[model samples]
Structure formats: structure tokens, C-alpha cells
Target: MLARVRSTNLAVPRPDPGAGRTTGIDKRPVDRIEVFRPGPRYGDGPGVVGDHVGDTRHHGGEQKAVYAFSREELDWWEGELGRGLPDGMYGENLTTEGLDLESLLVNQRVRVGDEVVLEVSVPRTPCATFQRHMGERAWVRRFTERGRCGTYLRVAVPGTVRPGDPLEVLEPPAHDVDLRTAFAAAMGDDRAARSVVDAGCLPTIYHERLARHLAGEG
Candidate 1:
């Protein structure tokens, strides 16, 4: 399940000084991550983004380039072509460039051809920084709350992954409960909320610590 990806465009951050706000989104760069390459950005560490004040968050982390796939995807598919998701998101380690992240079920481990292995965690959640960057009148929160935006992934087996590797799905969607689905269901519906919570598939902040979920919370 390998996949090739390209930064469809860059999300440039412009400062909003007159409004006392800072940061904006620009869809222009093809590989914003590579542009931000201050040096070798990958290694055996958590490829955490966010802790910054800009778009295409790949700042302050160890593993490697923390990219966010936008309204693009690998020019190929190895499985189901699910629903249409977001067009542009502000923060992420690897923005599918276009593919759908929701289809990757949580715990349905993905191995980037031994280059990288990450168990699906959840889609990236929007924050104040996102709203500030996008400046779309709550659009940031809406996208995240609605499960359209992609999120973060804590690297389990740290390895190098580029834009031309296959995004192999090591396992299929389990019980139809991927992070994207869980997020969409949990936020507004109590029944779906309970299910997502019970499964601990919700974001770490939204998760409920049941005995079952504890075992896999690693």
C-alpha cells in the first residue's frame, strides 16, 4: 500500500498586525516542507508539528518533515475511494497532498515500506492558531469538528518517508470506525459519541479512559 505525494501548494502565513493578529494561510508552495528545510529534518524522534506560528506546520520536531496533505492525493489508489474531505488544512505532519485520511482506521497500522510505520492516531484538531491563520470566521474549528481536516500521527516506528513511497495499509478498516468517522460521530451525537469514546478512538483530549482502551493507549 505505497503512495506518492506532492505538496499541491504552500500555505503561507502572513501577519495581521493591524488587527493585532498574526499568521495567514497561502496555497502556493508545492513543497513547503522542503522549503523549510533548515537542515536534515528527520531522525529517530517524534515528528511533532505545531509549537509555531505559521502555516504548514513542520516546526520543532525530531523525526523529519511534518507535512500536511491538502486537496491533493497520490495519483493512484489501492482501495476504496471514500468521500470527499477537506481542501486545505493548516497544520499536520503529512498532509495527504490530496488523499483521504479518514479511510485509515485508527490502529490499522500503516507501514511506509519499512521507511516509516505509524498507527493511525486521529485527524489533526484545529486550534486558536488555526482560526487565526485561516481567518475564515470559525472555519477552522468547523472543518476540524466536522472531520474534514487531517490531523497528527505519533510515529511508532520512526523511519524516512518521502513523496514517492507507497502508503500501504497493513490492515483494513476495523468495524468501520476510523478516526475521521469517530470524530464526526462523537462531536455532536451522544450515541456515536459514546461509541467513539468507549472505543477510545476519539482524540486524546476527548477520549474516556476505560479499561479496554488503556491497554492500547501506548
Candidate 2:
């Protein structure tokens, strides 16, 4: 089934107390986001529209410009966490529906609305900020084991996007590497992780970590 953008969220770089440290992970909802062809600072810099990211070292850039989480997954998390996970609560720029986000391949291209096109980049790695945000004990471990980490996208085409926009998959990469596989590799399996790096589908943002894993340095 074709997926649709259920809701869109944006926020300027702001201090997030709930971020549990000096992290800019807290994003508030905004009306619209003007997307642009990705660059070094596509999601975190001034040129992009309404959406802004807190951390550049690990969060923003062409490879992870737009973070997307499926409402379906959120529903599941809500059940597990025993509470409602409002849209944007996870700091996702787009809350999608009808898409199997976990299965999307790295380098897959998806068209949103009439202009914005996004290339799937990588699976989000849950961090301490995320655990603090949710206030759940063992949140990171649970989230990692659950393996439903949402996807990050690089803006391939620029345009304005809003809630309820149409979403279409333009193409999927010709590789076996998927979000879960990469996640597992990063966690420990050098063989699995090296495959993802060798596939050349994942952006450069992940190379350093993968290299460390392969070299027993991570």
C-alpha cells in the first residue's frame, strides 16, 4: 500500500531541558517546512525551511536531513510504554502512516507531495537523550532490542511539504542491507555491519562508526 504523510513537524534549534543534557533533541511542532536539495547542513543550517536540528555532529546533514517515524510504530510504542506518543514526541520531522518504515532500504528514494524527494539514509540510533526524554527505565536497551528505529532521509529535491501530503516510493536500492541489519552490525556484528558499509548505499555519516566496529574500536 502507498503511504501518506500523516503529519509534519518542525522546530527551530532550541534548548531542551528534557533532553537530559546539553543536547538539542527537543523539537516542537511547526506549520510548514520548506525543503531544499540537501547539502552539508541541509537540515541543521539556516537555508532549509522551518525544521532545525539540535546537534550537527550526530544528527543533521545531507544523510540524515529528515527523520521519519511511522504512526503505526508510535502506536506500538505507546502500547509498550503505556502512554500515548504524540506526533513529534520522538523528534521525527514526519509522522508517516501506511509505510513499513523498518523495511525501507538505505538509498531508497521516496517522493513526498509534488516536490520534496527523500533518500532513506540510516536507522536512528537511540541515545541517552532519547531515554531521558521518555523517562523510561532501560529505554535505550528496550528500544534497541525492539528494532523498530525509524528512518532518516536526505533531501533529494526541494519543495514545501505539509501534513497529509502524498508519499510514493521512487526506487529501492539494489542491496540486502536494511535498517535492522545496520543497527545490529553497529551494535556488535562486524560481518553484518561491514556488508552495509561495503554496499555503498549508506551515506558517509555512518562510515566512521562502521569502521570502528569492523576494527574492534567501537
Candidate 3:
């Protein structure tokens, strides 16, 4: 994998990537997301607040997109990226400053918007494309084990959201049932596997797969 880092102006994130900085991605918190297509709920502006992500192929809801992270993860990213993680550099939507991504446990409850609560599901495991982008040596699988990678979320209940909005954790995870645990349990007892997946709030396909595995069909 090639570490395609541009010059400081291009590579590094913008305007104080500090954890508390809410202006840009680098400063944002967990439960993070950027609206490529701000839908109906999102008002028109440069980085409007209380906006909706819009519709997708699978899930349907007024509030479309969501993101998450912790203060520690942002700091960690700064260390990993070797500077401020500039916006629009690596295609990362939400910067998630100071949130030690490695510590973001599975099944963690990441409240995106005020009323839009979402649970952290599976880590964003790097595919070949990611390998090409980051290096193959980037240790993509480590993210899965550490639960450092961000998870895709489906809206449980719709709510209005905006950039710079504070992300809250309505419910914290009960013990760290990270991806490692999930994979392990999945390979072990069927019911345990199913339980772990359900508890993690994984994507529907994963949840269904676990259910099937529990039924002894897989």
C-alpha cells in the first residue's frame, strides 16, 4: 500500500484538528459523518447543522448519515497521520479528533444527533482498495481487532442533526465485545455467536448471518 501523503497544506487536516474543534473533520467527535448529499432535513449552508443525510439503497430514514469517535481517537489519528488530518485528503468523512480509535469498542452506543442514536457496529475493515490507498502494511486487520475502525450505522429512530453538534452516548457498551470476540464466538457455539452479533448491533446482513449460523443452517 502506498502512503500517499501530500504536502502539509494538502495532506494534513485543516483548522486545528484538535479533539474539541468542531469546525472541521479533524476537530469533530465520534458519531461523526459528512453529508455528501445533504437531504431534506439538512439546511443549505457550508457545513450546516441539524441536517439529514438523505436516502440510501438499504435503510430509509429522515436523518440519513451519522458518525462517531472519542477524544482519544482523534489524538491517536494525529499521531498516526503524522500531522493534522486535513479534510478531503483521504476521503474520510468525519475526522473524529482525540478519540483513540483503537479504544472504540464494539457495541458502543454512539449517539449521532440529539435524538438520532446509533450503535457502533463492525469496524471498517480495509478492502483491497483501502490497501491500495493506505499501505498493505497498514495492518488493516488490526483495526478490526482493536475496534479502532468506524462502523456503519442504521438509524434506529429518526432525528435532526447538524455539523458541530455534540455527539452523546446514550448507552455505553457492556464489556468490550469487539470484532475479535465476535469472530471467535461466531466460530464457536451458534447461540453465543448470534448473541454476540445481536449485542454488537452489527449490520443487518451480519445479524442475519449470525441468526442463520445459530440455526445451524450455515
TM, every model: 0.57, 0.87, 0.47
Off by over 4 Å in 3: 1-71, 74-84, 87-92, 97-109, 112-115, 136-138, 142-146, 157-160, 172-204, 208-218
- Sort by TM-score, best first: 2, 1, 3
> In lDDT terms, how accurate is model 3?
0.42
Q: Worst 10-residue stretch by lDDT in candidate 1?
A: 74-83
Candidate 1 residues lying further than 4 Å off, grouped into runs, are 8-70, 73-89, 141-146, 173-175, 202-205, 209-218
The TM-score measured for candidate 1 stands at 0.57
Reference-based lDDT, residue 6, model 3: 15
Model 1 agreement with the true structure over 160-183: per-residue lDDT tens digits: 555444566676644567766665
Candidate 1, residue 66: how far the Cα is off, in Å: 5.3
- Model 3 earns a TM-score of 0.47
